[model samples]
Target: MTIDRSSMTALKVTLIGFAALASAMGVGRFAFTPLLPLMQAHAGLSLRQGAWLAGANYIGYLVGAMLCSMRVPATRHAVRYGLVAVALLTLGMGVTGRYDVWLVLRFGAGVASAYVLVGVSAWALPALAGHDRSVWSGWLFAGVGVGISLAGLLVLLAGARGYPPAASWLALGLASTAVAAIAWAPMRAAGASAAASAATQHAGRLSTDDWRLVLCYGTFGFGYIIPATFLPAMARDVIPDPAVFGWVWPVFGATAALSTVAVALGSSRMKSRRVWAIGQLVMAAGVLVPVLWPGIAALLVAAVCVGGTFVAMTVAGLQEARRIAGVNAARLMAAMTAAFALGQLAGPIVVALAATNGTRHAAGPSLLAVALLLAGAWALWRSPD
Candidate 1:
């Protein structure tokens, strides 16, 4: 009935990793999604401008992912330093209303987020596996969704109370700072263990399967991002009530948080790639839902479907990376992350260009995303178990 010392340590480590991810990804990377509508209403921000800000963040993500792939920073150092950067950059977003300044801040946050993501995975996954608590990975990754839900709910509450975008930004920044403080010591304890493991992994070229995994991950990134980026805005268009439309993002994030844990619990017999394939198919269906149905109801369905599967796909893909690359998994994880970043970087630009051409909704890009997701799912299905 009593938990052992090692078990306690493993749980502590997992919770720290969870907090790090929630701060880095939920606040640093995605606080903008829920805030975009507030910015549009109170700050006179345009959809085209929002798209540019999103694009800038994704570009920074690509840069950070590439740096991680090269192993430019130690895992613990990267996580600790990156968390600090994320807190600063997120707070900076509220310091000014200038579009140019916001661009720079979002970009910096993106870089910090990628570093934390790769660093945490590199650091925590091994420790969890060592303790035979690998199932805890679902909870670790669930930080992204939980963070997303928290950020969304905060913004939703603030918007209802007549708070401006800056106020919401400040609130999230303060919250991220607190999370960083909590995660600091445990993350520092990761030391050189992750790097030592990486040093022993294969230095050979990637196989066809590895390459396929990277490409499919990239497709998944592109496929889900349109809705991920603009679901709140899209819902706002369909129904203008902030109280009503504001619920979309939190619903999306809640589904995402819960689904990963469910998959972790139930996927013992399934191959990681197979789980990933099914997730993609489900996401593709979600992307197609609004286009086919054209209503607020459909958008909520898309949110559930897309949000639910994206994190599951992320867990599956990363687990597959570890299975295939062993101790060398960090580099492979980074490479896959870079590809995902590239896909993410493209999504906003696609939307920006569409807006420039006077297309308002995500329909056009959503269609393209669905096609690519279907293709990715097909490729993943063909991959060996």
Candidate 2:
């Protein structure tokens, strides 16, 4: 059988698309969550400072998403600038001896990550047809999991070997640059002709449901981030082995990757609102596990449950936004992203209040917040015309 040139080209395009999306989604956004503890320890950051840094990143993400949603030319220019920004910001993260500078760098990284995610999703979605759209989109999103897991592994290796924090960050930055270089060819091809057409067709103002979805997604963001940003440190406090902390993150990322696919499949058959509510409930249960059990097993279970639902909520929330906003999907997505950013900003502050009591009991208030948010989401899901 003779191989067709067009078929080969299409295969190459698909592979490249996945790689680019993975680089943008995975390494760009998620690596920070897993590295929080290392940054805190090496940089001598207080809990409040750590929360502020995390919040700053989310704020930057909000800014980037909003910027991308506004003008076609700005969005296009962002793709080129965003990659370089991420490379530099990530490289700067290595030099965390200065808390203020690290906070600024993390914020820059968040901005760069938001642009990459929004830009790539916009460019990639139209190229996909029917089921391929969902599949590719889920896979692209899973890049966050892959990137997170890799970051954990790298940090674990670096920390164990007693590498300087700056060196580890620098290495991660170099790796990101390499991924960006590999991604450049495919991103350029994907964005070449269709960018203008897609922008014109998809760009618009946000709708009422867009607001509701944003409010709901912001709650989901608060619910998930509390666990993600603090779980490792929590585990380290309870677990006897320092090495155990490293495993928690990989577990979180791995389960998150698997659950994202599951949610994508479930969305096709079930209403997104229902799926989202259920995911939140599941996450609440996960959050409570460590609180109730106060052991490594509980922490492991919590990571899986919370990690799975975090991305699932985003997927379901975005789908709901599309249904509610109709043609204004891009604007709606940006709005939801903004809501998520605000929620993320609030999460650590909320958790910090619980931590002030000087007990692992902090997990209790955090989990309670998650449960209440999910209950509210369920009510929202049930509401009808």
Candidate 3:
């Protein structure tokens, strides 16, 4: 059977969207976590300061999401402009040597990354209908895993070859630029068509139920980021083996990718909110494992669980937001993104308090936060539609 041109076009656009998301998320966000040690050793930043610098990115992301939510011509042009901004920011990160300078660059990169994510999703979701949209959305989030894996591998390779930190950052930036170029053509082509017009309009607003979904999703974002941002460092502190550190990130990425698929399948029959809550509970359990056991095995298990839930919660959250918001989906999604970013910004700071006593103690507050938020999500799911 022959597929229509629109179907083929949508498929291409979907692929490109995945690539774009991978670059934007993997290289832009996850890369920083792994590189934190390098930055500290080479750049002379304290743990507290490093955490704050990381939080700065999320703060910028929150601002960017809120800005995109407004109905402005420039905001509407974010799909193309955002991609370009992120690509440039990624490259800029390579050359900056000073901590203050790097912090500013990371904030800029965060803003660009947030815009690309919100804009692309706003554009991509309308190209699909019903279950296909949900499925594709899961796949799109999985792209982040792929990107993380790629970034991990690159970092490993760079370290092995004794490449300077600056060079490694540059290589990732180039990879992002390549992906952006490939994505631009199809995104533009897709956006020009009649179907694109309808999809954009369909993505315009948010309903009351969408607000509930956003709150739950925002909580998930808060719960999940603490572990994700710090897991590698946690593993290193516990394991201290270079070999183990190398494996931790890739394991997290691969498992997270697989988990996104699991979430998509599980949610096929389950409510999106339920699926999201389940993922969060799993994540909470993961975060607690290392606290309870303090071993390499437990750390690895924690990595897998946390990684999986991260993508799953994102996919479920976005789908629920779209479903509840209908035409106002983009605006609702932007609000949710802002809420999520706020949670992320707060996570490191909250966890750093735990660090004062010891890194392990931080797990208590982190797990509690995740549990409470997830329980709230479950409650929301059971509420009237």
**Most TM-score-accurate candidate:** 1
Per-model TM against the reference: 0.96, 0.87, 0.89
Candidate 1 lDDT, 1-385, residue by residue in tens: 1223342378887888889988998998899999998898999888999999999999999999999887636877888889999998999998899999999999999999999999888878877887788898999999989999999999999988889999988988999888878777766655646556555655557778889988998999899999999999888887878898999999988999998898888768788899999999999999999888888999999999999999989999999998998767888899999999999889999999888422355788999999999999999998787
Residue-level lDDT for 71 in candidate 1? 60
TM-score of 3: 0.89
User: What's model 1's lDDT at 297?
Assistant: 96
List model 2 lDDT by residue over 1-385, tens digit each. 1113232243443455455445555556666665666665666656667667777787788777777566433334455567767877888887557778877887888888787766655444434432245545565556666667777778777666656567778888888787777666545554544455354555555656556667777777777777788777777667634466778888887887777677766666888788888887888788777777887788899889988877767667766665676445556677677777777767766666555532364666676666767765776677551
- Model 1: lDDT of residue 195: 53
* lDDT for residue 249 in candidate 3, whole number 0-100: 77
Sort the candidates on lDDT, descending order.
Answer: 1, 3, 2
Clashing pairs in 3: 204-327, 204-328, 205-327, 205-328
Better by TM-score, candidate 3 or 2 = 3
Candidate 2 lDDT (Cα, whole model)? Answer: 0.67
lDDT for each residue of candidate 3 in 1-385, tens digit (9 for 90 to 100): 1223553455665677678778888887778876665555566656677677778788888888878666422223565666677778778888887777878878987888888788767666655552255566667677888888888777766665556668878998899888877766665555544234434453344556666666776677687777777776676677554455756777888887787777776666888777776777788788777777887788788888888778777877787776776666777778888888887878877766656623565667676666766675676767664
Error of 3 at 160 (Å): 3.9
Question: RMSDs, each prediction?
Answer: 2.6, 4.0, 3.3
C-alpha lDDT values of all predictions: 0.88, 0.67, 0.71
